[model samples]
Target: MRETPDTPSPRSRRAFLRDAAAAGLVTAVPGLAVSACSGAERTEAAAASPHPVTPAASSPAAGLTSNGYGRTAADYARTGLTPGTVQQWEDGFRTAAANDDPDVFEWWYSDFTGDDGTVVSFTLSTRLDDGFVPEPGEDRRRPRSAVIVTDPDGTSHGGTQEYDWSEFSAARDRCDVRLGPFTFTGDLKTYRMRGHSGDVGVDLTLTGLVPPFRPGTGVIYFGDTDDHFGWLCVVPSGTVTGSVTVNGKERSFTGHGYHDRNWGNRPFPYSVEHWRWGRGSVGPYSVIGADLHLREQYGSATVPVFLVDDTKAGKRLVGAYDTRTVTATESAPVPYDDPAYPRDYYSKVHWTYHDGADRADFTFTDTGQRIVSRHYLTSPTDAQQKALDRLGIDEIWYTRYATDNDLTLALATTHAAGSGTGTLEAAQFGLADAPPRTGSSAS
Candidate 1:
């Protein structure tokens, strides 16, 4: 397992900010700072994956405060929280070159073992850029596709599927996915994903890459914030592949197990194409979940889309939420790095929507989260370049929840009555646990 990122006692950010500013790398805005280069030369491709591991530079400890989180705008690009505006520009760039908008840009794969050692796994990703940028050459759109699998370690594996239309089709929820002869079901209750790599099959680890910084480029953000959602939890499966017997049947799968949770609190209004998700326990009973939201510019509006895994039955549109009860909380610097930073750490949250006949009372807890700080500089004209300035996003998240439910959640950053007062927004809603699995495996 990789070493966990540091969750300092709120003071470390100041120190990091001071060092960045002292190096003559200050952002014009007081609310955020630019990440300075350490004079280390890096490949252009690798530059996008900044700050691989700065958490180790801090002091080690037992447990961190439960409510600890961040609101850093610079960390956006480094983490994978694609703001709609940034994606809009990137889509424009792709349009000018590829001539075809990609159906899926990002994905997630997760494997978990339930308490009984029943290996369970899932994957999810986006399809067709209905709301994404189109290629300069191609005037038509294609369907976005995604897939997921479970019991990867069982005699018969299980999973789900998804597809999206760019033109005029409702987003298809849980569709069935075929793995060789056996078929897996899809649902909104699970996360799903798909991607290409000349390589055969890839491991769906529950971690994402953080981009490195470039002066004027922009930061990267990851996790489920503002407008996306993907969270999967694992309880007790062990590592190792191959078939295993469960309920008198043998099975086969590809990965190991770790107790965990996966969920998001992203805002809507931003256009997103694809995503992948997985969850693991950062602490006992407490889970740590992560998601990747791929954004591409559409037209006038930024559409935020998501992909989920339905591990139980033939999937359909899962219950989702578009809530209005969001609330924000502001905080101050604790005292670690830079003192000039004056922005309050904002955590905008709303209740999860529950689907029921009588009362619509629903909820999901964001058990824990950590910040991935990033800094960059960029011009506002180029989508990739423009992504740098407005690209800075605060991705505060939770990995574990109280129950297993299907829901569409969101998080967002809103301007406070004016043009540029940055306010962080985060929210989640529980949709439904979904009906139980039915019928036998499909072929």
Candidate 2:
């Protein structure tokens, strides 16, 4: 499923290309500036509008500490944030009003060689997942495009290419990236990169590729199409392929396997979902897990999950965990024309995860982020508007300081429980921060 915003949306050609150029490693854009209002009340206006419908018989509540938030839909409307798409379902997969706010999801990994933060390489993947269920019966082709921009003063460089299956399992992805200062290369099948931070300047490389399976996979993803009760699965397995480069050195990788965030529910007290790090002789594992509980001002509880993986085992294990910090870097006041909110904006978050063998620490400082504030009409009675809310950061900046980095990882389902019951494996080592993938399915 693909979604293209026909209503002239904001697009930054330079930001897109700069992100692509930092394919092989970490690319840090300037942190986005946002409004820091004192005594800022959490209102529906501050968040995406809710969908309208006969309220669910009961709403699941997520139990977590309040960040001193006290406001409802009414109070928020008083603020500038306008309500757009809102839909409340009487009986739906997940309760609450479905808000169709424009959102962008970007993941970045910066791998350092032997502590001391020396020599870095990173890969940044960005996507826009505007919320809307294809207008019920509307199967219109969603317009999508990725543009690469160069920093003329900084000497930007990167590559562009797509892959086609040469044989059933034998796949080949083509990419052309500029390696060093003012150098452009084309059709480079295999390459590797290594470099210092300031000495290197990177840009974007656009592709004409269609998203597989889920739409809005980039931004706010809901339950999976196959199983309405569970969370959405974006990169299921062996579907995404790209290479990373930094400074003058680079590396070519299959980026095999898949990883996803599950937004499932749990009981009270255990309200926050979590993902942590673990190790085994088989492969380094990161758990994409979370804790679910009830919130102070909600009917039921909500489950917020994240993706966690480490290369101690053969496959970087992933599961959910508790403890998350979503810092809204670019919180603009409501009303699109508001001068308080900046246009080229984004968000950043800090989270922690643990699993016996290792403790995972992640500080995601994502820049160049934006979300669509719109309304959703699930049904005639279910009309609602989701206000502009902060989305995921462009970069998943993280650090895995383990008790035993040599423990190796073993794959388990990204949302599975128990031990010795996983199938994924990690193939890259030394660069343990990079997410590992496998051919097996972990649902």
Candidate 3:
């Protein structure tokens, strides 16, 4: 099954591209700063004429530590660094993360690289299940679940499944959820994912190396509207012990694991056109970071969110603001062998991070990156579905870069600097407008 969005509400342009993004991995030609698709950006507004949905004023419970969080919706409500921004998780998958927010979206993501050049990643999010609003007759959910595994040989394959609302289940109080053949069960300390993909499958367990990283109320508000992004690095740092199989041949991988969740309602392209996200284990220290933009309402920073963690100095929540900064200097444009994907915004990025007097710089060279697998998502509303259906070709190219980098991490006085392997994703979501395809036509 293809991964698609739960809402059918079309934004602008063709609804299919937005809908497609909701489901899974898509590759198309696009660029940053330029419109990635023929889509329109919507100005979000709250229903003052509103529903009785909980307000964003709630905060995590006092003294409730991040590691103590569980699958319960309330556990999440009490997450983040700020109080009142959190909300309770309810039965069904959506409530556990998105609750009653419209344009609702969320995901459970994990990834790890084996010592033998093998790379594996997984995402189980709002696309995997449905229902942020409580309704017995609401079955607007489309393609519900997703699983992708890139094999050691660079071949990528996985599965996306949609279930009847009656078939999907989300534990009312914990992180126990099942949408089709994908199952995720976890407490604060550890989590396990078991996925099925035809003849291939992945069963992995991840144990946290640090507590969950909650920034602010985990909500980043965009402009005056309710269009916002919620991010929580649940497993900011962790160790992996699992087995992956391809056509019945299986091998266990012992390496570092990273998991996080992100949710939003508005079409992503409308927010910011492009972004670079990455997480990797460099020896004993785990690293996770991202640099992205979300227009003006996101404070004074040129880059709304620029974060990096060595995983040893706890987590840099909202407290890390002002002091922490990242400057990404694009070295060069990445070339795509796939002519259909003409955009090459992917670059060799050099990032310099600063926290007060401490400084750490790392360059993420675009090397050893390739096409492993792909997935899809669609618009939710019937009207949007029809809109998407008319778009013909799907969304743009979303590429992943696994780089070899030398990072220097300084905390207070001590510094850890070394060369290690890391993974970064360069995705042109066409988050705004549609740019002309730049490469050669496919033969």
Candidate 4:
């Protein structure tokens, strides 16, 4: 994930640090830019590539036209976007929003699940709250780091820390990022991470087993030219070997790990309503899936992304964003702490993907162990709470859970079914006024 021949010139380090001090937020870097090519241009680019990626399967003859999002294959065909292609510089930091836009944010996140049932996860971010848009001159973008460690006994330990902007620096050419005492640096194939917050600490190395991946250009547009979100799975599934320290006690572990990067300039409450994202390995497959629901103004589209790799065959079975090839369903309402908000979130989700003669079905059920539950408004004033309520932002919650997974696959040459364990995340930002729940708990 470092600089390649395609990398643009990076911003001056001195200027970045100086402006960071004055503004207290990590704005866009000089070389960070988004490609807003026209449909014709994108088509031309696709035609030029030696490997022209396309949807895994043709549209179903008589079923859902779009993926979870209301986008049909024709829509993607018009935009010339698919669920493949990984630009060399896509894994680096993307802070390309206007300097004065408090909505701009970026983060690198990783999690490891040990063979002995322990889980360790951490994140280094420019901002901790996705729903809080700061006022002009407000200093709220200090570099933030958070860690969570879950022991085999189901106990979780970790905390969040914020540091001055002076302590933050990241390379535009690759994935070299430092915040305070923590560091995360790596190439797309391998990574080294070391950090600590509160009583938990981790020093780990991750070796990639699958190549880096992104859906199409890895950028999801929101009906506007400049409004979009970017995502890249630098390490879809990897081998993690490292040491974790808790309460001054250290233990060594070998396990599986996953890492992904996210960056956007649009406020969460105004853009995304909720999303279900998870990743794991089952049988001979390593899989990642997500269901993203946009807000009403953006046509309330449901965008689905799913990827499946056949480790045994050493090839990809499915990498798709079309409804005919990928779809998802969820049930079992998981009510929020605030009673006034609707139970729009779910505790269970099922994803299905079909490509040619290969197919995969994955179901993730929450084990009822909540490792982290964060409320954006930790301490809100009366007036501020009122304003948020008027905007229908009942409560913004971010929750991570330990999950059990059941998977079945039917490929051209193999058929298998198995069960495993993994991690799942639920993010609710603007679901206060969402429609009434319809699905029963029985799926």
Name the best candidate (by lDDT): 4
lDDT of 3 by residue, 1-443 (tens): 01137632222212343344455432322221221211111111111121112213122222212211122232233221222222223111433444433345566677776767566777665543322221111244433666666767767766666666565666644467776677887765578989776766888898876655544445544443345455666667777888888788888878777777666554454455455666655555555556664433334233423445545554442222222355665555545566665454545666676767777676676575654423223334554444334433244335676677767877574567788777777654432323324533222
Over the stretch 18-73, how does candidate 2's per-residue lDDT look in tens digits? Answer: 34445632222223112232211111111222222111101112111122121223
Worst 10 residues of 1 by lDDT: 414-423
Show the colliding residue pairs in model 4: 1-187, 1-188, 2-174, 3-173, 28-95, 66-323, 67-323, 68-302, 69-302, 69-303
Off by over 4 Å in 3: 1-102, 128-140, 195-197, 295-324, 372-395, 431-443
- Supply candidate 3's per-residue lDDT for 387: 36
10 residues in a row with least lDDT, candidate 3: 38-47
lDDT of 3 at 301: 30
lDDT of 1 by residue, 1-443 (tens): 01115532323433554555567554433222234323112112211222221111221111111111221333332223222111111111111121132321322234444334444444333222222221211222333232222232433333343333322121112223332222223221222322322212323322211111111222222222112222222222223344433334444444434322222222221333222122222111111222223343422221121112122221211212112221111122122122322222212121222233211211222222321122221122244233323433322122221222222322121111111111111221110111122322212
Q: Which of the predicted structures, 2 or 4, would earn the higher TM-score when compared with the native?
A: 4
lDDT of 2: 0.23
Cα lDDT, all candidates: 0.25, 0.23, 0.51, 0.65
Per-residue alpha-carbon lDDT of model 4 for 364-417, expressed as tens digits? 888887766766765666655665666677677777777899888887766789
Ranking by lDDT: 4, 3, 1, 2
* lDDT measured at residue 200 in model 2 versus the true structure, 0 to 100: 41
Best by TM-score: 4
Among all windows of 10 consecutive residues in model 2, the one with the lowest summed lDDT is 54-63
Model 1, which residues run further than 4 Å from truth?
Answer: 1-100, 103-113, 117-119, 124-383, 390-443
Model 1 has a clash total of 91
